[model samples]
Target chain A: MLEYIGKRIWQTLIVLFLVSIIVFVMVNVNGDPVQSLLPPDAEPWAVEELRTSLGLDKPLYVQYFMFVKNALQGDMGISYYQQTPALNLVLDRLPKTVELALAAILISIIIAIPAGAYAAVKPESPFSKFIMFGSLAGISLPTFLSGILLILIFAVTFSWLPSSGRGDAAQFLGMKSSLFTLDGWKHIIMPAATLGLYMVAMLIRLVRAGMMEVLKQDYISFAKAKGMPGRIIYIRHALKNTMIPVITVIGLQLGRLIGFSMITETIFAWPGMGKLILDSINRLDRPVIMSYILVVAVIFAFINLTVDLLYYFFDPRIELN
Target chain B: MQKEKILEVNNLKTYFYTREGVVKSVNGVSFEVNKGEILGIVGESGAGKSVTGFSLLRLIEEPGEIVSGEVKFKGQDLLKMSEKEMNKIRGNKISMIFQDPMTSLNPVLTVGRQITEVLIFHQNYSRKDARRRAVELLEMVGISSPEKRIDHYPSQLSGGMRQRVVIAIALASNPEILIADEPTTALDVTIQAQIIGLMKNLIDKFNTSMIIISHDLALISEIADKIMVMYAGDIIEYGDKGKLISEPAHPYTQGLIDSLPVLERDQKRLNQIKGLMPSPLDLPEGCKFKPRCDYAGDDCPEGTELFEVSKAHFATCRKAQFFSKKLMRGVG
Candidate 1:
């Protein structure tokens, strides 16, 4: 198992390296940051001095190597806009994004697994039909629209929740998170729901389809023949099998939730990496954008590795070697 | 001798309500299994042998319903019992093992867990006691080093070993009867013999009545005391194993017996039944096997009901007399 993890970590490093090169090339190939930084009436020599100071005058390959060397030492240059270390800026927003993603995934799992299992077990029931219909609607509805609707319903009309921003956060395990406070939970509910709605919809369908397929296997019939209680048969036998595929989707979706929660973040003005990345992209803050993309790539690799490891746990047939 | 009937069925009809039409899979079949007897239900695919086995345990799922039946176990009407009551009887009083050991046991579960679950559920054995019993059961089923093998998952075991685990699970609660549907069909030829031998020993040791369903007539004849031959959804021939094999009264049975290759005879080619079994959905009018039978005559299209071919032997064939006489002359 240790060897398997070592192999996975090696693969993850290669993937991150490729992602770094791609993000570096794509960011540099776009219009120059120097052109955007200086004012229209600025002297040409002043612009040249600013460019030299920012190290933009160097060749692209040399700049990339310099960036890589600094990145290896936990430095990712300075954000042109923020005038702070790019990695620090990204790391500052990382906690909120991770919290939101984790909460969203927890909500999706708590709702989707039971709902999906029910849909598969009693597929002909009215409640199952309703769940299926709701999931379908959830999948089609855009995050911005859903976020606004939730804000309108809970904040504007019912006045049950705060519509925007992260409320008072308490430090837990060296990370400031809203999850510990009731008021913070009220503030977070809308954005998390908006961010997690599509995942809930997708996971429900995946779990249901997977459960249905597993339920059809001969093992399920044998379990029934063994006279196992319906609860044990469904949860212990069927749901465990269903979780194999569902876990894969959940890992991938969690990575997506953390990285691409831009629209929901924008709607609610939640202080997270999505909003930071969006701002950096518009201002052409090369350092922050590069760090954000690389961070997300690492997250993807990490999650994929975790999912592969989880497969061995869920299915005994899957050998780690 | 008057043997005790452990299970008796009266006109059990399990039908599937498909989109096309109602598939009468097990059409009004009646049979009985005596205590300590091994009854084998033999047929080709789609002949309702497996359905019959499932119907006894009420394991038939959606779309397929046991529309009408009276299943009496130990003089109690099993069909009339509540589902809760049936659950008590299933796996506890009457356990079942399925074909394809590779697929029958839950892959994620350890063999010990699967076996112990039955003991815990039915017998109310404590976790510790169940674990101990599970090892004993595994050892009884011919699995070596039961101590270590108990912790291993189904995938870790060979096919024969997996089937042995399945049998161990079935017999964990010491069920009065076991229903094995095509038990050895998914096994290797050599493994098949070993499994068959293991099952025979286990059944005799426990004195458990069994209904072994399979398509292989030769395999059935080896283990079954009584053999019931099914065609389409009906029992065409049923009798004592010795009588049935020696003097197959029905033409279909005769064809089936003839199809077996004999070691004494160096035949250039093996005998085969001329045609395939008729489709269940669009069966021919009258006899279901009329299209496939060489002895099919003018009167056969009207269909023939099962009649006594000999004492304790029944067959549904118009030319039963002529077929038996031909068989007798051939034997002489």
Candidate 2:
């Protein structure tokens, strides 16, 4: 198990390295952000001076080497637009993003698993048909459109809650989070629902398909033949066996949720890393954009690693190696 | 004196409502298992033997339904009982072991846990007591080092050992009627003998009435007190073990017996029945076995219900009555 974990960690490092290279190349290929920082009427020499000062005058390979070296030492360079450490800016909003993403996933899981299992058990029932079609609609609608529609319904039409922006509230642990407070719950409802509903659709389908397949297995028949109670048969024998694939899908999607929260963040004006990244892109803040790409890549790799580790707990058939 | 009947089935018809047509999987099959007797059901593939076993437990799934049946266990009509009531009788009084031991047991659970689960659910054994009984059950099935073997998952065990575990789980609550559906079919010949031996021993110890379904007549005859031969979802022949094997009444049963290879003699080719079982959806107007039977003729009657040949033997064949005079020499 230790050797397996060590190998996985090594693989993650190599992946992160490749992601850094891709981020570096992609960000550089989009032309210089230093050029954009200068005013439209500024003199060419002033632009050159600014470019030289920022080390953009150096060869591309030399700049890449410098970028990588600095990155290794926990330095993501400084944001040209904000004049602050790029990593610090991304990190500052990390907690809020994490909070939102976690809540969204929590909501998805809380709704999807039981709903999916129930649907799988009664595939032809009216209740299951409603759940199946509802998820279909959820999947069909894009996140931004769904987010806007939710705002119109709850905030515009009903006048029940705030439409945009994080709630006007004090910070919890230096992050504007509604995780603990009831007011935060009200604020989080719209964004989380927007993000969670889409995920719930995918996860519900995954879980339902998985449950149906596992329930058909011979072991399930054996369990039934043993006269295992309906509850134990469904939950312990059927559902537990169904979760390995669902967990894999869940793990892969979590990384996507973190990255894809950009639209939801923009729609709601949520003060999170997604919004920060979007603003940086609009301004073409190269350092911040590059760092955000690398951070997102790292998170993706980290999440998959955690998922692979999680496989050992759910499925005994899987040997760690 | 005649032994008390432990299980009785009357005209059990399990049909699959498929897109093409209704597949009569177990059509009008009826038999009885006496107390402490092993009734072996023998047939070729797609002969509805397994379907018969599944129907007994009401384990048939979607697209298939028990169209009509009367399954009485210890004089109580099992078919008339509600699912909740059936659940109480299932593992506690009537349990089953299936074919393919490799897939029969849950791969994720330890064999011990699987057995203990049955004991706990059916017998109301506490965890500690169940664990102890699970080990004993394993031992009863001839698994070595039951304490350590109990912790191993089904995947970790060999095919024979996994079969032992399946039997152990089936016997966990000491069920009065054990339905073993082709239990040893997935095993090697040596392992098959060992498993059969173990099962017979366990049945004797528990005074369990058993229904052992198999395709091999020889295998069934070794453990079965009475033998039932099915053909295309119908019980074509059924009788006391010795009488049925010695003088198979139906032509299909004779073909099955003749097809068995003898060790002492070498033949140019093995005697085999000419054709496969007719598709259940397109069964003929007359007897199901008529097309396959060697003695089938224009004189062969349309009605194919079991006709009593002797005191305890019955065969669903038009030629069964005349076979005693014409083909009596064929009997060894």
Candidate 3:
């Protein structure tokens, strides 16, 4: 197991290196950092001084190596707008994004698993049809539009929930969370639902297909022939095997959730890394943008590693070696 | 020699409602198994033998339904029993082992856990006792080092060993009737004999009634006291194993027997039935086997019931008398 983990970590390092190269090149591609930093009326000498200070005056390859070296040491230069360590800025906003994604995934799993299993068990039933069509709608609609639609219904029409912003937060495991407060939960509901809707839609389809396939396996018939109750057979024999594929999709989607939360966070005005990345992009704060991308890449790698471990845990056929 | 009837099926019709039309997988099949008797069912591919076994356990899935049938186990009508009642009889009184041991057992579960689950669910044995008994069952099925193998998952074991585990699980509750559906079909040729031997020994030790389904006539002849040969969705011939093998009144049965290579005879090629069984959806108006039977006459009747070909032997063919005489003359 330890050797497997070591191999995964090595792969993660290579991935992070490639990601850093892409992020750096992409950030630098959009015009000059000097022009974006200095005002239009500023003296040429002043701009030159700023360029030298930021190491932009050096040869491109030298600058890239310097940036790579610093990044490898957990330093991605200071944020152009915040004038603070870009890594620190990204890290500060990481918790809120993690919490939102985690909550959304939690909601997705609770709704999707049972719904998918039911649809698989009775694929042609009206209720199953409703879930199937509802998920289709969820997948088709954009997260931003869904977020606005949810706000319109619950916040604008019914006034049962908050429309935007994090309301009355509490501390959870050293991170600010609204989970402990009713008002906070009300405020988070729309954004979480919007993000979770897409996940639920995808998961339902994956889980349904998986469950349907698993139920057809010979083991299921054997279980039924053993006279195992329907519920036990569905949950223990069918569902457990079904979850194998579902868990993998879930792991890959976790990174997507964190990456794709930009629109939902913007609509709800939730303070998260996605929002930070969006703001940094508009201002051309290269350090912050580069670090955010690097962080997300790392997160994706970490999740993939964890997912491989989970596969080993769930299936005896998957050996660590 | 009236053995207690452990299971009896009456006109069991399991049909699949397909997009094309209804496929009568097992059409009005009736048979009986008595205590400690191994009844072998032989058929070609798609002959509905497996479907018959599944129907007995009510294991048929979607698009398929047991339209009308009576499965009496120890005189209780299983078809009329509620799901809860059926659950009690399943695993506890009636259990089944499927074909393809590689796929029959759950890959994720340990062999021991799979067996123990049946014991715990049906016998109400404690987890500790179930575990102990699971090891014993494994050993009983001829698996060596049961202590270590008990923890190994199905994938870690060989195909034959996995089948032994499946047998162990089926026998965990000491079921009164065991339905083995092509249990050795997925194993190696050499392993096939070993598995069959293990199953025979286990059945004898437990005195369990068995319905062993297979397409191999020679394999069935090894242990089956009574043999039933199915064509399409119908049992075309059934009788004592010795009598059925030697005489084979039905033309299809004769073809099957003739197809077997004999050590004494150096025939250039084995005999084979001329054509395939008619598709269930497009069955002919007359006899179901007429299309494939070489002895099929123009006046062959449709839906012919099993008629006595000899004392205690029955065949569905209308021209059994001619074949009986022909076979007698050839042998003499």
Q: List TM-score (chain A only) for every prediction.
A: 0.98, 0.96, 0.97
lDDT per residue (tens digit) for residues A54-146 in model 1: 998999999999999999998999999989999999989988998888989988999999999999999999999999999999999989889
Per-residue CA lDDT of candidate 3, range B1-332, in tens?
88899899999999999999999998888888999998999999999999999888887887999999899999999999898999898888988988999998988888887888888889899999999999899889889999999999999999999999988888889889889999999989999999999989888998998999999999999889999999888889988898898877888888788788888776788767787778789987657877776677766755568878787688887375567677645643
TM-score of each candidate structure, all chains considered together: 0.97, 0.96, 0.96
Candidate 1 residue pairs that clash: none
Ranking by lDDT: 1, 3, 2
Residue B112 lDDT, candidate 3, scale 0-100: 81
| Per-residue lDDT value at A180 in model 1 | 86
lDDT of 1 by residue, B1-332 (tens): 99999999998899999988888899888888999999999888999999999999899998899999799999998888888888888888999989999999999999999998899899999999999999999899999999999999988999999999999999998999999999999999999999999999989998999999998999999999999999889999989999899878888888788778888776678788888877678987778888877777776636546778898788887374577677545543
lDDT per residue for candidate 2 within B183-238, as digits (tens), equals: 98899999999999999988998899999999999899888999999999899999
Each model's Cα RMSD: 1.7, 2.0, 2.0
lDDT tens readout by residue for model 2, A200-220 = 999899999999999999999
Question: What is the C-alpha lDDT profile of model 3 across A226-273, one tens digit per residue?
Answer: 888889899889998998889899999899999878998999999999
> What's the candidate order when arranged by decreasing DockQ?
1, 3, 2
Rank all candidate structures by their TM-score, best first, as comma-separated numbers. Answer: 1, 2, 3
